[model samples]
Target: MVFMGIDIGSTTSKGVLMNEEQAILAQHLVHAGIGTSGPAAVKKELLAAAGLQDEDIDYTVVTGYGRRTYAEADSQVSELSCHAKGSAFLFPDVRMVIDIGGQDAKVIRLDSHGRMTDFVMNDKCAAGTGRFLEVMAGILQMDVSELEQEAAKATQTLRISSTCTVFAESEVISQLAAGAEIPALVKGICGSVASRTAGLVRRMGVEEKVCMSGGVANNGAVRRAMEEELGTEILYSPLAQFAGALGAALYAMEKAGKEKEHE
Candidate 1:
């Protein structure tokens, strides 16, 4: 049977297709997310990639911030649950997960059986999120993707005192005007985000074999800074951004199997 999962996040949408054996058939990511064309775009591209149509999918599950509004899903799941499942699937020994998305950051702890034990989220502010980095990169007149390369060249790390996005932006500007090196400032920006996220991780209690999910996990500079702040290696996959979608697809597969058994 064919199963599908879609994660409609704040700034991106991800989709995954799988078969009865749980083998991934296709995966797609769209830059636009909920309330935009992201969800529809992911569905179309994912189906086309797998050489299948919507009706061919035996089950469809949705997760993420926009899951409730997505009418095409057969069911909806919470991002927290989905992330836990996805991270465990990717790293079977993972005991902790840190997901930094566009607008928020979350730290989740899992039991030995891969069940979620505790989680802490920073949904109230934009600091320490992908949006925060994007804003900082913009002020530096550079693309967000260049942050890692720039940060790598830093000779020293400047400390950004403000944890608020607006205030941090002002701090960056002030430092730039004062002849601060851009690379050092970039490293500092990443360090600031790491420090804030580390606080959340500490609140939930750090565990070994920590894995990182979400778009920010793709940022090498931020990941390095996070590893240093937490004093542990953060494991991540190239498919990190799709973890939520993959987890939802796994749920779809399970649901499909159960329905067939009942029939």
Candidate 2:
């Protein structure tokens, strides 16, 4: 049977299709998220890619910021638990997970069994999130995707001491006006995000074999900075952004199997 999982995040929607064997069949990501057309688009694309229709899916699970709003899901799970499960699936030895999404950041500590032991989250502000990077990218007149390349050219790292998004914006602008190199400024912006996120990680205590998930994990500069700040190598997968969705799908598979057993 096919099981599906969808993650409706603040800035993106991701879906995964899997079977009883736990092999992924297809994965899709939409740039638009909840309150937009992202949910429908991701589901439609995922089904098409897997050569299946919605009715073929035995069970559906949802997670992320907009999970509760998605009516098609058979069940819903918290993103924190989902992240831990997915990260463990990707890196069986992973003991920690750092997920930086559009508007929030999370640090989850997992035991050897892949169960979540503790987690710290920052949902109160946009200081260490993908949204913050988007704003910084806008102010720098470059796309978010360009940040890594630009940051790599930096001769030195500049300091952005503010943890408030507004203050950081003002500081970046001020530095630009003061003739600070854009690359250096970009590196500083990434560093600021890393530093802030690192604080969250420290709250639960650092552990070995850390994996990063979510859209921001795609940012190499941020990952490098995170590694530096935490003093450990960070692991990530091309499927990093789909970690939550994949975890949800795994849950769906398990639930579906239980139903079959009961039948």
Candidate 3:
């Protein structure tokens, strides 16, 4: 039987389909617009990718910021639990997970068995999040993807002292007005994000074998800066964005098994 998981994040929606053996069959991710249309968008895409129909799915679990609002899921799970479970599945040695999404950031501490033991989250502000980077990129008149390339070209890193997004934007503007090199400014922005995230990681106490999950994990500059701040190597995967969905899929598989046992 096929089980499914959908992660409706603030900025994107992701879906994963898995078989009884918990092997991934297909996955889908899409930008979420302002409203609640994300889950529906990814559901159609994921089902098509897996060559299956909605009726073919035996179980479903929904996760992420919009989980409770999703009507199609048989149940819902916390993104924290999902991230921990997903990180463990991908990196068995991972004892910590740093998930920086569009509008928020989270650091999850996991046990050796992959269970979430503790977590710290920053949802009150957009600072140090993917949104913060996007805003900086906009101020720089550059694309989000260009931040890494620009930082790579920097000969020396500049410091951005503000942690508030608005203040940081003001700093960027002032630096630009002063004719500061764009590459150095980009590196500064990345470093500020890393500093903020590293503080969160330190809250739960740093652990070896840290894995990064979420869209921000794809940013090389931020990753490198974070590694430097934390003084530890980070493990990342191309599937970083799908970690929550994968974890939900794993949960769906277990739910399916419980149903079968009852039958």
Candidate 4:
């Protein structure tokens, strides 16, 4: 049977389809574009991925910042739960999950079975989120994908004084003029974000076997920075961007199977 999961975030939407055995049949990521268009667009892409329409889906679940947008979902779950579920699948022993999205970041502590125990989230600021990195990359006349690599090469410690993206860019410029190496400046930015996220994770008493998910998780700099701050290697989900969707889909499968068994 075809089970689907959809994660509609501020900047992107991801969808995934899995079979009864939990094999991923297809996955797709699309820009959110405008308003609820992200989920709507993801729905279209999901249909295209499976070569079938919405009705063909045996079950559908939605999660993410815009989870509420998919009112027709079989269920709408918190991103923390979805992240934990997804992380556990990727790293069966993961007890900590850090997910950095465009507008928000989350640190979820999970039990041995991957169920969430507690979590903290940062949604009020862009300091350490994907949006901050993207905005800073733009100001530096560079691509967001290239930002992490540059940040990873710092030879000296560069301090980023501003938590705000706008102010950070101005600080970066000032540092650049002061003979701060490009790598140092880049590292500073990554370090700033890593520090912010690490603070929250530390407060929760994070454990090893950590897994990170989200589009930001794709950034090598960000991952390394997080690792340095945590002093451990973080596990990666093959489908980082689609973790929320994959979790939702997996949950949908369980729900569907339970319903079938009862009938």
* Model 1: per-residue Cα lDDT over 1-263, one tens digit each: 89999999999999999898889999999999889989999999999999998899999999999998899888999999999998998999999999999889999999999999999999599899989999999999898889989999999999995379999999999999999999999999988888889999999888999999999998898899999999999998998999999999999998888888999
- Residue-level lDDT tens digits of model 2 in 1-263: 89998999999999999998899999999999888889899999998999998799999999999998999899999999888888899999999999999999999999999999999999599999999999999999999989999999999999896389999999999999999999999999999999999999998889999999999999999999999999999998999999999999998988888888999
lDDT of 4 by residue, 96-174 (tens): 9999998889999888778888999985988889888887777678887887778766778687853677788789888
- Give lDDT tens digits, candidate 3, residues 113-181: 888889999859989999999999999999887899999999988899647999989988999899999
Candidate structures ordered by lDDT, highest first: 2, 1, 3, 4
**Clashes (N, CA, C under 3 Å) per candidate:** 0, 0, 0, 0
Candidate 3 segments exceeding 4 Å error = none
List the candidates' TM-scores in order. 0.97, 0.98, 0.96, 0.92
Clash pairs for candidate 4: none
Candidate lDDT scores, in order, read 0.92, 0.93, 0.90, 0.83
Please give the lDDT score at residue 178 for candidate 2.
99
Q: Who wins the lDDT comparison? A: 2
Q: Is candidate 2 or candidate 3 better by lDDT?
A: 2
lDDT of 2 at 168: 97
Worst 10 residues of 2 by lDDT: 159-168
